[model samples]
Target: MRRLAAGVLSLAVAGILLAGCSPAPASDDSPLSAASPAPSRSTVSAGDPDLPAMPPTPAPSAVVDDAAADDAGERLRALVGDAGRPAEVALLGDSFAAGEGAGSYQPVRGVADSLCHRSADALLADAAGTPPSPPGTAILHNLACSRARMSSVTAAQAVEGHGPEGVPAQLEQLAGIRPDLVLLSIGGNDLGFAGLLQACVVDTEPCGQDPALRETTRQQLLQLQAPLTDVYRTLGAATPAPVLVLPYPRLFDAGAEDCGRLSSTELAFGLEITDALNSTIERSVQAANLPNVRYVNALEDSFAGRGACSPDPLVNTARFGPLLNAATSVPASQEVLHPTQEGYRVLTRDLLRWLEENPM
Candidate 1:
């Protein structure tokens, strides 16, 4: 029965990859090449009961489990002194924070809302490079979901939750739990990532070359400044915890000779988009000026030279193939343009480095 379930799970997970990961297109036919700006995206606001009940998932990944268990032993061995309390950490935001792109959801027992595409290899669970503290050092509440946006994550709603199963906003969930730390990565959806994907991958025209489109995107992103500042303020006021805002990595290096299926123009455009995103985030964080809220340039260096166009890309391309589990099943469609497990590992390594250098 277990094996059978696993097989079924593999097929279902593959459904995301095999079918394709295109989001509903924007109103303007040419997303990036359009004469007019694309409209803002709709997020999970006010009980977004659109999706059907989630598919069953395989058991959690063993890599994290083993690492956790070993860390526990190490902790036991080092119990003579300085046994600090575990930090209760909360993760909030979209697919990046949810680990949705790392492949294959892991069903955490009693965590129904975790069907929000939680993965075992999300950065916090295990350190990729050097040991920063130990594994299992923090009590994690991963409240991130695929397709999440600013509206879905903040405490703006009057109601309890904005999504299925009454899963409250990430901030609301964190409020109830009173975590000691928070990690957030959002804003891409607000800028219409899906539409951008359609433009770059689905369309034949050189959408990237359109100066008007780029300006439109920039204008849209700029509009988020005030609201983002407010969101940062809300977060700071909500908890005494340190809020580390992580910006998304550039999906392509844009300088490499080979760009897979992506044209050079598209890759260059991707770089521009990422730069704009990081800059927006940094500015917002700075404007917030809260001692607790800090921005981490998490992937700018680590992801360099390892873009979708590179020979050893960390980010996934549309329908290319799975990085780790090619034989078992294809990658999830949500994994498209998302970081692979290895990519997550690199992120983990960078995060650990940051933590070590700047201990709170």
Candidate 2:
């Protein structure tokens, strides 16, 4: 019976993907192509009731399952390979690292209204759990937050609804603690990925086809190179630990017809934006020339045939219907373009391989 239900669900999903591939009618004007500039950040109200509520911060007494911990330890041991001492690791960046769309977020410490969106299911959490840290050593300090921008790392910014006052800068979280490695997945928010997706998918007109809007967005993305470079330089100088910058993966396969709400034009535009973003990040890292900093090409060829339109996509295409429906305001689930748990695992596998090849 369960197998039958699963098969039905699979067919439904496939039908949706197929329907999305049909050519959409053109509109005279698209909301995305409006002359106005895109908002600098996400507009979703932090206090929106529809947003998923994260769990309260677990007390020390809330122990992780022993069997799971043991499994994680074994995986870490295998990855490290005889490096008895586990490497101290920290995770920083935006929703991707925070596991926003992956499901199950960890509550903010002391702030009941917070929506920082840190999740135990995040890849960093998985990586941290896999290794057995020496007694008294912190294995991972995940400071990544939903809608985090480059400014979040550089400035003392307040998370909306998190607290009355602006929270300390994200970089400050690393002030005193020096980890062996810092994995960063940021810059997407800065490029306004969520807004772009909404504009392209939800609007009556196809916004991605507008040359003016595309150029404007491109220029804005290009402008980020400087700030991104600064971040790498700052992190490298602040800690001796190596910084691995994970660029956003290509969400769609080139030449694919469509995936759910994402039209072919939208997919092409999204690919361009993603490529530009990745290129900008790579360029910034190269210009910085920091010995401790390196860009991880985890996205290149990683999702290859398995884009949003594929039978198996690394990204979350399952939420397209809900996202398009005005009635559904599921929080964090709107984390369009973000990876699934399976996607993160793929990324984790690549990351582990990278670490194995490049031993510190």
Candidate 3:
């Protein structure tokens, strides 16, 4: 994390965080992250070795041409809803940000490995709502892959091994594609939230009360400030298009006593950690203070009764029956802990609402 935050030249990247102040249930409880580390058998391993810490980032505009700003604004206005001009939206982030755990997935390219479970049914897949798509109105170019980190956006990556040269850097892709909007979700994997969840899933004993684990994760999250600020700046520098960032809605209801095998302490850990994550992201965006970034930033509250263990779980939960069963055909279990189709639909609705409220 120190290495990730050291380098500076941009504002923020495949971003995560929100607006809200849900209190932690206990002093010992710590914040967690939004990414899921597990990869499908056909995909690449979802891990990136930590880079040595780099120097702090400079101003995002330092590398960008000042002349592009007005051009960008004009481009956005001219293209949006134009009968002949198509508006493109670029998406970046991890499993939570991608179409993971929801809808059908796009076909993986070639025989090469990729963790990108990019979904054809993704929330942004249809920018103008139900298809037949507005002719030259809006299009979605989902660059998000599962387990992508802050660096993936700031630096060029090697995961999407489709063609001989492979995919370009996501940030660069934004410049080349020059979409009207960019949506991001990241930071969970960087904080190693996967390990914390693994601790909870593998052990019945509460993992939330572990002071060392909580503190360590908390510190790592704080380190994200600089890099988060840089990436958003870099993103802002890359184009005049607006950036819309979304937070992962709560997985388990914080107020709920338990979620399946998860105890109250475990539940509290998830809830508080998520709140911290969103708050951190919101603060970073504010620090960058770029005019183009729009985060309806709040600790997600709309999906209150629709948590993982709720009567109506918008997010997918563990399927112990499938895990323990010998002959049950419950399909695959890759979507656990992520959002369901319904969740994606609702989030899409919220995103559109925010867009409506914050027009270009």
Candidate 4:
């Protein structure tokens, strides 16, 4: 196992402190059934001999133009629906979907609020209550938890472990409900991103120069394809709804200089990892070949000028004291890598646009 840096450790401690101050549980009015019992699976090996060769990862670029954004908005406005007949939507995955960096997290009924960290500010939250146009509501069933891997979608497991002993599988939360759409943002934890970031951001050594870490990350990336393919296939078979798989956005601009705690070299290394993770997801979706399952490429275009190093960043990049002391304060270092409330808003915009253009 990799060693965590002092800064990262401190961030973890800070998160725990923040969790203690969270408010009481909210109403459990979501359109989901009782949780299903966890399922068993064979131990996943590092490399599966049956897997095929993956394509080369694409270079990071901003592909969405102003005309595209405007066209998407127009399409959304044109959606026809009966008044008060809301669309049933389900959300699943890890920190990104749960809104870790975005503040105002909503507490689960039976579980500790801090464990799942499903923020009211999450993109799905915005989409749930508010439809693309007026009089068209979106009722949501969110089962996203922080630190969730692909396995967490279908098996009971210990997640980020900040506030609860264990969490029920996300799929279990969707037992009897048939949603119109399911948005999933997952697979980063399987890559062991927390540990990788610790080494890159908090440690003294440049991540690019660390052969052992790089090799390990590469191996993990290779191992992820089979399991990810399996997950997509399972979700496709289980749900009649269209399952949209959202990939992680680029956190830094490779061509730009570092801004905040991350150095230029460190930013470049992080970008490489992000690309590899996204590539793996895309390849796995293709391998699944489910017509109902489609990959969302909104992040690349939506996050164009909003990396950690950008002049107007969607993701957080502030250092400790300044971040913690701000009027709209962010608590920890882990939070720094995640999308802010503004970032989530931008994500929601892109998602709605994509959904409008590619109607199911």
Q: CA RMSD for every model? A: 11.7, 12.6, 14.0, 10.6
lDDT of each: 0.57, 0.59, 0.55, 0.62
Best by lDDT: 4
Off by over 4 Å in 3: 1-84, 108-114, 126-137, 156-167, 322-334
Per TM-score, the best of the predicted structures is 4
| Position 240, candidate 1: lDDT | 87
lDDT of 2 by residue, 202-256 (tens): 5546667666656566566556778889988987888887788887766676677
The full ranking of all candidates by TM-score, starting with the best, is 4, 2, 3, 1
| Candidate 2 deviant stretches above 4 angstroms | 1-84, 130-138, 318-320, 324-327
* Candidate 4: 10-residue stretch with minimal lDDT: 30-39
> Pairs clashing in candidate 4?
none
Winner of 1 and 3 under lDDT: 1
Worst 10-residue lDDT window for candidate 1 reads 39-48
Identify the superior model by TM-score, candidate 2 or candidate 4: 4
What is candidate 1's local distance difference test score? 0.57
lDDT assessment of candidate 2: 0.59
Estimate TM-scores for all models.
0.70, 0.73, 0.70, 0.74
